[model samples]
Target: MTAGSVEVVLRRAGAPDALAAADVWLRSFAAALPTVVSPRSGDDVRQYFRDVVVPFRETWVADAGGGGGIVGVMVLRDDELSRLHELSQLYLDPDWRGRGIGDRFVRLAKERGPEGLDLWTFQVNKPAHRFYERHGFVAVEYTDGSGNEEREPDVRYVWRP
Candidate 1:
């Protein structure tokens, strides 16, 4: 899809794309949730992308074609044992919001986990809440900031096809 006038492609992320993917996540997190605290340092998040996410998860990136760098990132986790599929992480460059890129990522996540998908977002992120709800995700549970590192009240959303 085209992000404004620039063409954007969604593709599987490899080891080499870890740094750029993490950068998008960091920037998006900072811009979208300024008041929320991140327990991990930038380096730690980058390292996690390199060591665990890219290697273990179904990681995808919205690439601004022709070496324009990653504008968005999405990670999916499928647990066969529990029959659980999670849209673990989804982030986009702050400048790329409202450009249909996040919509594309959510569509991909739904396509990948056609049976169902679950995700968690801070209750304070009302924009995200609306986005997910528009995509047919329902808030199934809520928790008082105790379980997450951010200690922010969060809600779990689930989408089933």
Candidate 2:
């Protein structure tokens, strides 16, 4: 490998990583939903994830190999209907994107998750739509923002092996 090469590693999120994961989540969300989400302090976001998401969701964190620190996070929830999984959230540090980390993350999710998976993204997130599609997920439904926090139009995507 070249001296300038970046090594990325993905692993399950641990208790000690919840805070850093939340911080990454906040930074990604702020960048992706700047107009839709209201301003939130890092502490508030930290508390919300520690109190809410960490308790309920299965999570993963991506590390920059060679002690480069966390650069991404993913959260999944089991679907009661079957073995299918629901992707609750996935975010990459804005600075770390476009370098194949997101692709590697998605590929890992597909390997660990069941044959089917569902995910949602705001309609305004064209980049997200493209990203998911590039990984073979297809839009299966659309809603008028009533079911989500942003109250913004959103779409549901599904991936099936």
Candidate 3:
């Protein structure tokens, strides 16, 4: 796709597209976290997609060209405790990275007019941290490694308009 030629359309996802979205999730996450163990089968991916990704369809699915399928996704929810918009999951297909799909997804979220937004990332994910920082997010908190011994520390970032 040419620079600025890729057309990304944001819309609510339907049940039929859950599997494709899950595929995107699996691929994206595996690429982002190569050391982390991911689901081994399609069934597991589907189940996780149904339980996690499918339910939060309020503002999801960044479809390239309106028909090229879902290239990116951002699952958002309200943080009742902090009264901020929480970005639960944000992923883009490996092939679509750096094509402005990810940036547009953030732009779409900002356009929704949310008062504030928050998200978490692993400490090693410097690229993501930089991306968020560039988009106006600031690191608010950092948590030591959790239950997972292999997992590293997590950093929480917040953005406010």
Top model by lDDT, which number?
1
Which one wins by lDDT: 1 or 2? 1
lDDT of candidate 1 over 1-161, digit per residue (tens):
87667899999999999999999999999998999999999999999999999999999999997746799999999867547689999999998889898899998898899989999999999999999999999999999989999999999999999
Q: Estimate the TM-score for candidate 1.
A: 0.95
Off by over 4 Å in 3: 1-6, 39-42, 56-59, 65-67, 147-150
Q: Which tens-of-lDDT digit does each residue in 131-152 have in candidate 3?
A: 9999999998998857334456
What TM-score quantifies how close candidate 2 is to the native fold? Answer: 0.88
Estimated TM-score for each candidate: 0.95, 0.88, 0.84
Q: What are the Cα lDDT values of the candidates?
A: 0.92, 0.82, 0.77
Superposed by TM-score, candidate 2 places the C-alpha of residue 142 at a distance from the truth, in angstroms, of 0.8
lDDT of 3 at 78: 77
lDDT of 2 by residue, 1-161 (tens): 11137666778877777898998898898898787764457888788778777766888888775645778999888888756888878999888878777887788778877588888899999999999998999998999989976688899999998
Model 2 per-residue lDDT at 5: 72
